[model samples]
Target: MESSLSFSLPETLVLPLKTQLISSGSVPRSPSKLPFHHNVSLTVSLTVGTPPQNVSMVIDTGSELSWLHCNKTATYPSAFDPTRSTSYGPIPCSSPTCTNRTQDFTIPASCDSNDFCHATLSYADASSSEGNLASDTFNMGSFDSLDMVFGCMHSVFSSNTDEDSKNTGLMGMNRGSLSFVSQMGFPKFSYCISGTDFSGLLLLGESNFTWMLPLNYTPLIQISTPLPYFDRVAYTVQLEGIKVSDKLLPIPKSVFEPDHTGAGQTMVDSGTQFTFLLGPAYTALRTEFLNQTTGVLRVLEDSNFVFQGAMDLCYRVPITQRVLPRLPTVSLVFRGAEMTVSYERVLYRVPGEERGNDSVHCLSFGNSDLLGVEAYVIGHHHQQNVWMEFDLENSRIGLAQVRCDLAGKRFGVAH
Candidate 1:
């Protein structure tokens, strides 16, 4: 069966990111009391062929579209074929719902008759695709089943890493106003993941620990940077303290004045591998650690960290000193509000494989192209125990420092 509705974009319209951001203002109200934890991760039932092969799908807030891997016979290679399933429909581009889900990147709305409901989005890894703003009924486990329609992305592709990522596609959470997660009556759901555990679930419908808030409650701003694909969140910088081997390192004003807006956005991304700091900012930090580095770990050629030289040794800095200096509080000059993250949170234990006599041993921040884009990017590596909330309705994201209430207690006590 052929899909009856096909929404395509115009060939010549150009819209700026600022204009697109304004469009996001019209999105539906966000689910209330968000930030719920899923004791168990939820899974999606993917219908691949005419017979309906159910593949377990992951519910991700990081993506807005839902897709799965299949053979060549699969519709569009990257898209979900509506004809093969009983839960899809053809939504016209003129429809308000369609406009909400689609965006115009390389083209403009005026160039085509499709009303800008067709879009082409690209990811940081340079993967790109084209699709229309449409909806499809999705099954959320046996408990929460409904016609949850979302962007039916076509010709989609992404960079695969490791073995597990190949079969997975993204379910975007950043569809401006067209976000399907908000359309469902159950506005809030928990996306709980286990450390070192690839298997996680999407807690759809609702949970006891999760709470929903009004859309008008919080403030949110879209992050702007040199790199467009990294859909990042910007936060105010607040440095609580800076210490080198138990000694306080004085922070210079030239390095952190708010007006030097060139620092870019402090990125909150789940896709990136590590957090990067600017060259100037990194220099100031290194000055303090000069004495604290206990020993050196030889840097190898073609190192991922990209140190200045091929053979630079990374010195060890004691953890206790950075967290608690003589000063009552270590101030971090930031773009907006001054905030201090936990010392334990920043100090990472060197992976055993990369430790002593191996190659690099330093846990210090390094230079990354991402630094040029925005002030900082808080990658997935740093997202631990904290519950992050991206409320479209409220327009602001909330970060809560939380502990797993059921961590040690789950699975009948960890013998």
Candidate 2:
């Protein structure tokens, strides 16, 4: 069945955003504490089909392949129909495009009666999808790309249904050949996240403006030697230290480092909502934070030594509209640069429906005790008001503190 949702496609096409960001509905809460499975990932609006059916999807840099969660049953707000598009075709299971689950630890796929690629993706958050892989036309604005391959999911499962309402699928932006970024061949891309608006700008390809702006460069580290499963899977940056205000917190760099046997280094995830620090790293951060703002911030009652304990460092503030003095600008000190986390971005406003009051906010940073001391994740929330550029070609990333204007976007398609 064709969807009847009315939305206008952008009139501009050439420099169509291979990496764009938008927002959706959902209440983000701790998975164990509440049923809300909200994410702060940047969502992109996809224009699919001949007439162009618009669908929202999450921009997951950690994932390798892009897939649309299909359900004719209205389980997903939008889905791609290969049968309807003349440009659509399936990849045979024998093709290199079709990978085995055990071979490279890639997405799990099986051959159907027609020998088409059928795959399943299971995430750490209990979100999963089982589907058939196919190729078709992918359009954004006026720009059109032919024979792009993606997944048409048969069934999708997530811990939160509200998240499904926000996005129909995943737009994997990893270094894998199947990812949207690789398919587009835009090695250099940049984005700026808004701390206040929760909206941002995405610019793909080379630009002269890159040199004009003051940018701090850091080497993008990868897994020592990569297999298909480990190659350019995530943006890993070496974090040297974390500073609260003018004082640098006394936490060892080893506390933030990840085992090379694992994903390697600290990760920069645009899809994850909250920043996660390991046990020792978190303890030092929390203790220092509380010690500095002792009387300024009041810890919530019925909570453990560190505010609400493991899950968060919540506080009861008398905030209605103005910024509170209790909130500090947390900085993530990287190898080549330091990123100042905005006070607004560091704290989350507890929804009024839960506590029946709007005065409570919790730190977006969380303890990763449950996941073990694996790696530190600098999530989307912590990157607010910062312009982060991913230079895949050079294996480096540039960061700067500034809000970018989205007007007068340049458009061009590389042949």
Candidate 3:
């Protein structure tokens, strides 16, 4: 029987930069009880093991293997203690799941001296989790508990300390065999992220969401042949062109095509915080954006003004100005549909004390080339207030603009 479930994502603030921006009133906030914070990531709560120990996990569509910090380390106090769970069963190295089913992972599964299936999962930010593959009962607010496979990470290495400690683990929502959505046998799942509070609703299985707004769909691209650096399991989509203020850029369509190595494809990733584009696409966008904002806003030409070595197109705003000048809209034209990004989503107000008297706002889009990945990624910031549905059965992605806060209230998902 097919089972459907709903999860309410509560906002948890992470990343010092975003925290400062929210505190400084640079980012908008709501006065309601469910106030929205510009959180770096969205997290959902779930119970694990026999006694049902609660765990908070980040929702990451870009990744496949779900994992949890295990065996109380000095750093992680809320880590899952597998020994305490009566139903905890570690898969042996001889199991097919450890050998053949780990293809979705960047690193192959290995056998430890204890004869258990060991796996190492790596991320784009150079962080990694080394752990053993194990099965446990997951109670995700469903009528019945599910026996699911996940990683019990013993050691985690992360470059960003502030971002890593926010969540107990990550719940991978990708299309891989071991992902939460795939393991649950869900044909379709939908999520609506509130632009105001960053709180959202995640619905698993076929659910009607068109009552909010009409959804426009685009076919999901599949990579038949795999390459070393290319991610074959991502939610890949065909990007045809880009339009700044409804005017299409002069870039050719070939620039968006994947090379023989399968590198230049575009992916819709919730794990990434900011949108990133290939060299050609990013350059054209930056040039046109600067050309449009020349007279309206003061440009910040300082070489040190770059954020994360990707966002360099910055503008200075007086601290006294409560309202920002009108900015152009950016539209990402996909094969069958286009996503129009509003002016607020296009610019990120820089947070720090270094900007003497004026506030700095930079283009939220970044150059993907800096990450050495020749591809485009649409991040969560661009997905705000959007109802995104991943229809696995039809192999397509559906998108619609919605007031997610209201959606959450209507669905009784708001906390």
Candidate 4:
């Protein structure tokens, strides 16, 4: 557990946070230096005009307005151009969403102030966007009976070579925001994602996991500085079990190391989309894996497993390291209780074409390269059917496992 000072959520902090962390720059903070309450999940991606084009993005419920990358000099191109995205056309002071609109948000009526309710988005490469809010359509599989609106930042700023320019725009799915699901007041919704092969769901509002698995929630913190995406939740990371070559290793509280000396600040973040392990904890685990399965170990590059924004410095070992054969069950000890995870859950799967031995593929896990930005990122892939309760006032996070059938209905375990 780590500790971090709480900051009040303000409206003006959005620009700086986007400029520094979300866009291009990486914010350097130890994984243990964050408030347990700062977590949110959103659906984001980009698309072209009329017949929408396919663009990747990070969905954010924390934001109300939705926008995609655009361009100014673009002619009759095949698809959306990050180099020429939506540009913010100057709206007169009489505009509804900006001035005459309700003052519920931080956007002020005065256009002179930077906080004026104007839609201007910027990227780290110096590209910027200026646009307005517009209703956008959304459809996930057959669950398409919903309608919502998003922002069209007429002036989108992004470089052709910059990685951020790759996506169209973000979808907002925050608890208090206006999304298709939120507007329709859908009592239940789920976001499903698969890597190169497998898939999982991000269930919102309710799930079967709540009753099946025991869960615990951490505390919440207030954001003093205002940012466009300010909604957050608390998380408690517990180690259920650790094993190496059929040997169990006990992790003590002393293994925990936080940079700021803050207390009880460990958090699980979906926005980050990476899993980060502390230095001491990682070192111990790595040493154990190597020491036990020194035989039949293949020294392959960790880069083999790719799940978008996953970290690096990961490797794979054979199921022979453990006693189980079907799927190597790796047990984790979280909050004093032991939780066993099969290889399919955490390990990267290598297709038969890529397999070198008797196993289907290697285990997929988090990369270690995402050190300063996030310590432990429980990405969208591994957290499927897991109902996560983000309680701001209570300062805790609760997880409930769920089972779904081919019909996507609630059921027992997968097997």
Candidate 5:
């Protein structure tokens, strides 16, 4: 039973819904040699097609669809002509939302010879993409721009992604129905994650701010349910226990319960940067965070040098400490609310963006059982600097620890 539909606007044209903050632009990927920002990315600034073409996208809540990498003559970097959009459209195959998401998406038809509707999106770092499927006019940054239904991608399902490793595409904020917060009527959407600074803030609907606190809510848990009708759009949560120095890690809240065939599920994924646990909650949180930072923490090694890959609890410091030393008290509980987190927000570096200015602030948390199973994937370094609000018509998921207003102060849209 795959379905889709949601379109209703006329609250006097979009009433009181004015809080735009989409400002994101941080890209530091070097992947190894370990100054390890691991790929701190989050770009957004689109104005695609017809008299608009301003592309810079990559704000993906693990994607649902949104795309635009049209190839233009082929240098691939931000190309989007879509036939010079005059409101572009192209979706044929008798559009039943393109044969119901390509017959329940295992998406393998690539639709050509003129039936339109084609797609391929894959990534777990393998990186992929394939094109065709349009509908234009997506501006959404400086106050407004609409008429969505994206993906005009010219193709690159993978050949090791060249052309500067592509990506002038993807905006999908999942929980599908052709996402973008289900076509811009945001039943709830929020973002605030300053991995120190790429300058972030993405709230779109909800919050009138007459505040006295009130913002700690929880309940998202989907875990790609039994994985099929096109992989169930995961956002999962329900962790319930993990407080270090505040003590509480006998982990086994049924190992974070998630077994509809997706292994003890866990996914908060802001396009996964680092933070994965499951293998009994990453061996009881890497053996209780290395038993509370062995040797009282400090591992930016130069003298004793130790750089184990896939982050477990790295600490090494001193090439002139690049910040991050104030551990003990890690919190993640979430049933009623608990975020604590801070070892420089679990070790993320933006302090002078590190270009081999290496020292090591690792401890961004990992161990998805080394990708063999027992899943968990939090990422965005467990959402550094907090503040997320995905409400989706009250499906539940709110958080706090404010201070994100790139220029468009938000608060007013929580109904």
Candidate 6:
């Protein structure tokens, strides 16, 4: 049977530029629905456990296991109290779900002293979460209540700032066995992100795009074996080339392919806020972009103008200019498809960096070399106002351009 669900996202919740840059860090079946919000990260509010304890979770496609702050702490004051829920059941260490199905996690699962399934999840940024695997009844929007597996996190650690304090945990929507989408057996899911507003729409299960804009498809890449610094379970794709306006950059196609170590593969990750490319491709694109805008925009050459030590192409915009001058467009050429980005989406206005009537704007694309990864990532900032569909069954991704605000209304989920 074909199942589907629709939900809305709250208005844009703008955050500090530093927090937004640092936090640069979900699915159903049977027609269940839930709404989400656009904070620095995409978040969804849902009730878990018996009698329902509401918690906000960040939606991360790059991750697998879902987790929540289980106990109150000096940092997480509003954590979920498992003692108050009767339906909360921790998985046993002997269970196959804990021992056999944790290969997708960054760290292997282990047995705690009490024989409970101990889970340790790690991220690329060195942040980590440790807890026990547990199940509880989850309710969201029109979705029916069902017992879902998630991490009852007892501890969280991060090397960066405490930017995630406002969020309870994270919802993983990747292709791993423990992810929400994989656990629910959802065949397909879609989301439309708005560029102008925070209001967006997320749909799960079988989606009907007949009434929406036409879509272009690209095959999803699959890696059979695991490699260090590369996520095999991510939504990987082949990036053929790149075009600055109508001119394709002079970059070798081999620069986009993964090396023997499985690096350089491109992934569409909603968890990251900005796009990143490998060193070679990034350098070529950056040089071409600068050449095209040589006279149009004033370049910032100060050594301290870098953003998060990733984005370096900074520009100075006068406050008197209400509208930016016509800038070149960028197109990401993919296997059998391409996505063209407008000038506005290509440059990001640095928040909290405005000095009097002058403001600092930087190119949204960053170099992945700083992260010590040889992979390309298409982040949420580049996906604004686009309809992105992940078809797990067919192993393909669909892309289309549409006004997300209107698309939300059309789905009858306008917030």
Alpha carbon lDDT of each predicted model: 0.38, 0.64, 0.79, 0.39, 0.59, 0.80
In candidate 3, position 166 carries an lDDT of 57
Among all candidates shown, the one with the greatest lDDT: 6
- What is the TM-score ranking, best to worst? 6, 3, 2, 1, 4, 5
Distance from true location, Cα of 159 in model 3, Å:
2.7
Kindly provide the TM-score of model 1 when superposed on the true structure, using C-alpha atoms: 0.56
Model 5 Cα lDDT, one tens digit per residue, 1-415: 1113244332211111111322223222121100111234554554666688666555667667877778854556557777777888888756777776544344553667887877777765566778777787765433344677777877755433442244566677777777776767667766665544434455566643564246798887654234532245656667878887778988667777766565666667776666767666666776777778878765444433222235545554555665555777677787777777766666544233232545555556666666543556676656655677777776777787655433123322121
Instruction: Estimate candidate 6's alpha-carbon lDDT, on a 0 to 1 scale.
Output: 0.80
> Which digits, one per residue and each the tens of the lDDT, describe model 3 over residues 62-113?
9999999996766666588898899999999999998888987888899999
> Against the true structure, what is each candidate's TM-score?
0.56, 0.82, 0.90, 0.50, 0.32, 0.91
Best by TM-score: 6
RMSD of each: 11.9, 8.5, 5.8, 12.6, 20.6, 5.4
Q: Candidate 1, residue 314: CA error in Å?
A: 5.8
Mind giving the per-residue lDDT tens digits that candidate 4 earns over 1-415? Answer: 1112132211110000111113111233221111011112233322333333454344543333445544433421222443342332334445564554323333433443434345554421244556545443443322331234445555554543333443455544444334433454434333333332222333433433443445544333434343343223223354434664366766666554232333223344454333445545555665665554445345456455443333332345454554323434454445533334444565544433233443333334443443333233344444544545543224344554444222122321121
**Mind giving the per-residue lDDT tens digits that candidate 6 earns over 1-415?**
3333243322221111111211212322123345576756777767888888878788788889999999788887658889999999999999999988898787899999999999999876578999999999887555557678999999898544355777788899899988988876678778777887767867766666578877889999987877885688899999999999999998998999898888888999888888999888989999999999999999987777778678999898997888889899999999977888899889988888875678989999999998776689998888888888898989999998888888777666635
lDDT of 1 by residue, 36-81 (tens): 1221222233334333433334334444444443223333233345
Cand. 4 Cα-lDDT: 0.39
- Residue 174, candidate 4: C-alpha displacement in angstroms: 4.4
User: For each candidate, how many residue pairs have backbone atoms clashing (under 3 Å)?
Assistant: 39, 4, 1, 79, 14, 1
Error of 4 at 326 (Å): 6.5
lDDT of 1 at 192: 29
Tens-digit lDDT track of model 2 for 1-415: 1112133222212222222233322212221111111235566665565655556777777676788866655556566665676766788888778864223325557898989888777764567887777877776533434456788888888766666656768887766667777777675766666555444455555543643467889998766565332334678888899888878988866666665455325777766767887777778888887787688877665354242234567777764646677467788899998888866676776656123333676776878664543567777777766777888888888988875333212221211
Report the lDDT of model 3 for residue 369.
88
What clash count does candidate 3 reach? 1
